[model samples]
Target: MGQTLYPAGCVLDRTGKPVTGFAGMGCEMSSEAIVRAPGAFVPGARYAQHRAEGANQVFVDVDAYGEFYHDYSPDHPMTMMRDRDNRLARLSLGMTHYQLVMGSENATAWSAGVVHYSHGTAQAHVSIVWKVKNDKDRFGGWWPSDRLPLFFKTFTPTEDEARLLFGAADRLPLFDAVFHDSVIASDRWEFGLMKVSGMEGARFARALLYGTPTIWPLDRQEVRRTGPWLKAAHDDFRIAHGWNAPVALTGFRWETADRLVQTTSFADGRTLTANFSSTPFQGLATHCVRVKRPEKAAIDLCPPALPTR
Candidate 1:
């Protein structure tokens, strides 16, 4: 599997700082912060928790197949990530935008666009997403006014049960993201900066130059060669979309602005493509997940109550 293994990676600052503090995440006596938001922040927001299908984790490994286990409530959506206190983070983290794009992908009985199905029971789902800034300011809140990024619905995959759902020649949950040193506007591929290093300390750079990993291992010829190639691809994917494509992706190719990444059609309802762009990297980073039975159902998705003032 020359394809890289999927691991949790994060974006780092030039000084190698990984954890970023939200300058306004929890501002006191401020009408601008979401945590202190009026009507937006629910009182005792921490005490409420919700669930579904006898599970609470959004991504559950059931019988080796995955499904979105809901613990969501009228007060909170169980799909987003939780913070230190085992409670939802106050800031509308990436999940907020991710859910908006996934509204159309929900396979649950309640989704509107979904054709109520009769089969292996709409067991799992995945949403392919791309987020960029836009000029829409309608929500009437701080989150809406701060020049929020625009998230587009690239594609959505709802699987019929969870076997053989992965492999070549079909749309797999793993998104194929490519990182180019330019601005990209399509989901066929993504490009971003390489802020994290892999097994070897060979950090891939954001430019066409500085592009080689001189720190190759003394042994293992294949690792030495593939490492740099993989690093460059990861950087481009992150830079273009503010996120990283799945590392284990196979069966996709290079696409670009003029001729960009060509799209691949598959049976599992997922699309794959590559990208080539000419925009420089921005101050953002992202990581994509091949969620099994993703819990993006709108019928039961809502953010938790915001912590009180």
Candidate 2:
């Protein structure tokens, strides 16, 4: 399991006063301005002076990858450059000595060199308010039902959120351009093939567009239910870009106003085009993923459409 270690210090505002929380930090505020003063610590009284004064190490799990920043503690200052170098050194050591395939949670541009692939790169992180409104049983425990709940499968983002999360207009294929040859990028495992519900078509389309490998949860029953769809998607991807073909994502553009198309160029002079349009494309009944490879006829992968709203 991958982990990120952050140095402990009190987060400070622009005026150098320690902020209580992350709210209203704004673009001007720097998290790196955190100080190691005793008054700055949260729950200041609980931690003794000796313990707080000692080297502060905060460990974050793979699921909640923490941000990397400079630590301004005069005693043991950790700069951004130092942190990155440390991470790179560690990753290099692991790969070289252990012959391990290194992966992480989120694929930041800087870490792309050492890390092989990353999950949770594409996800609509629901706000706390939305979570509370939607998932009543989240805080209070509830018995598991025979079938998965709608909350687990479906999510509807607001217009701004949708544009930020799902719209292809503002996105660039820079990551694929740089690391597509070596890495197998993917979505979060929690939102895998059998997990996502209403916006399944959009997720699949995004995967094809980004040339990312599909993430599948390790649930036997769920796999039994949705295995065929997953297999077919994989098969289409595998056939288009051969098992060992030197493939590169060549082009991505808006085919139509609502339609996003991605073209993958293979080393063998063949190209694969994946055209994704919102469900009911040209009055079609289902959400469709249109894929065409050189010399082969175009095939549409249409699944039963669901209400995204």
Candidate 3:
């Protein structure tokens, strides 16, 4: 849980206006789940919609990351739920899910991996693993085996972006990049799991939201665009359903990226640049680049030079 601000006496900037926008202090979480039902799975299938003849299982998961390794302990509610699930299953159920909620500063964080049985038999299962941490720390902690067993590469959460970067070498773009790639890679090793279970789209959603339909335009534009189509569609949908948008739900921006270098400007006069690079051996990688702010005035008090005579 987090605190809310009141505008009556909220902290303001030099202009005396109420401070607006995120303080660059927040968290990012991601989740990935795979469900398989023995030999009945189909390979290379799109499963977002239910066909008239049959229905496929669709799973939605949540994840978080923190500033340190210990953030995965039982103190956080999400983590506690995961640990409790682990203790009860005792390997019989395996791990199925992950949750993470990191707050501003290294002071608050939580993470966990979970496993559970799907269908009537234990043959079907789900696994979710995640990490949460403070916003500023660039190099996240090492991978722990308390839940899913795989080595996650180092990563830094991006500020106000639709993507995440990971790996020690050239930061290869992990598509949407919020979810850990190692978990997905490990999931691939399961028994013909991806081909039949219609898990491809599910996994795709974990990295890229709206998958190719939305991403293709982003790929072409290399920018996020807001459109009247969204507003029109939203209003039309509301009218059709006799439902209105939530008071707090302002709107969403459609975004995409194809360039290596990108910059983000904050409402508080702070700007962040994402620098990316690639090597023949290492492939793609990204590093934390800081923005240099203007320095204050300084006095020049050098003594007068000695007379040439």
Candidate 4:
């Protein structure tokens, strides 16, 4: 098969509507939207391990489709990258689902979004994102603080502050994140530079700019492309939101001559593995699997339990 050069696309809203432009738009759909549209959500098989353990956990894995998986914990959201030396002040905890923005040639950039549904509670949050415009290197985009979890709701950074924190030239990149949680906790979240390569960054940029992946109601027949760009945008969403943990994804479990990479580890007694395929067609895809229950013995062994008395 030949490669697609400058393939056309557009951005879709939660209600399956096209987003007209990039000017301060919000997600109109609600938590019920995800519940009603089962086809739009990722498969249950993809979440088997996490489902077995429970819904709320500090760390979790996400499948970016094709062949990529990454980790994230509430403590540090961007653990998959090298510059993840920061803490998470607040995080949206719930059953999270992602979507791609595909439309006609009217749009000019790449974008994706995430909707978080609170488990055992009637609350949900949403985030629509895009890559920074005019940036030639690294991965970092503009994310609106409009709907952040309660604790950091007031976190409105100036253009310079946001650019410095994300290490991007554009103060406002793309995407709008909506966090809707009544309870906000006082937590620590630090901002740092994002670590990414030129090719990786450019590929993601191109994906957003060209590829047309399938979305809800709109299947492969509708989009007409495999949507590698959409997958890349989704992967970047995890990066921007700090969904993976750094300590857990430090090294590789295995790597093949064909450029397939895997990382496996044991955290809190549970077995976890992340897979990545660096091939050009499937480079941005991610798949993750977690197993077993957290080890009570490991928690008991922590030095904090020694007691100060």
Most TM-score-accurate candidate = 2
**Which run of 10 residues does model 4 get worst, by summed lDDT?**
298-307
lDDT of 4 by residue, 120-220 (tens): 11101111112322232222233434422221112333454343332211211121111112111110111111112122232223222111111212244
- Give the whole-model CA lDDT for all candidates, comma-separated: 0.23, 0.51, 0.23, 0.24
lDDT of 3: 0.23
lDDT of 1 by residue, 72-185 (tens): 222222331221112222212212422211111122222212111111122112332211112123111124333221221111213421111211122222211221111111
What is the lDDT, from 0 to 100, of the residue 199 in candidate 1?
A: 10
Give the candidates in order of lDDT, highest first: 2, 4, 3, 1
Q: Write the per-residue lDDT of candidate 2 for residues 62-177, one digit (tens) a residue.
A: 41143544544444456666645655655544445444556677666666666566776555443533453345343221235544443234345456655655555556666676
Query: What is residue 270's positional error in candidate 1, in angstroms?
Result: 17
Q: Candidate 1's error at 32, in angstroms?
A: 33
Each model's total of backbone clashes = 36, 0, 30, 28
Itemize residue pairs with steric clashes in candidate 2.
none
Q: Compared with the true structure, what per-residue lDDT tens digits does model 3 show for residues 72-102?
A: 2121212335433322332212222212111
Candidate 4 global TM-score:
0.18
Q: What local lDDT score does residue 104 receive in model 2, on the 0 to 100 scale?
A: 70
- What's the lDDT for residue 164 in model 2? 56
What is the model-wide C-alpha lDDT for candidate 1? Answer: 0.23
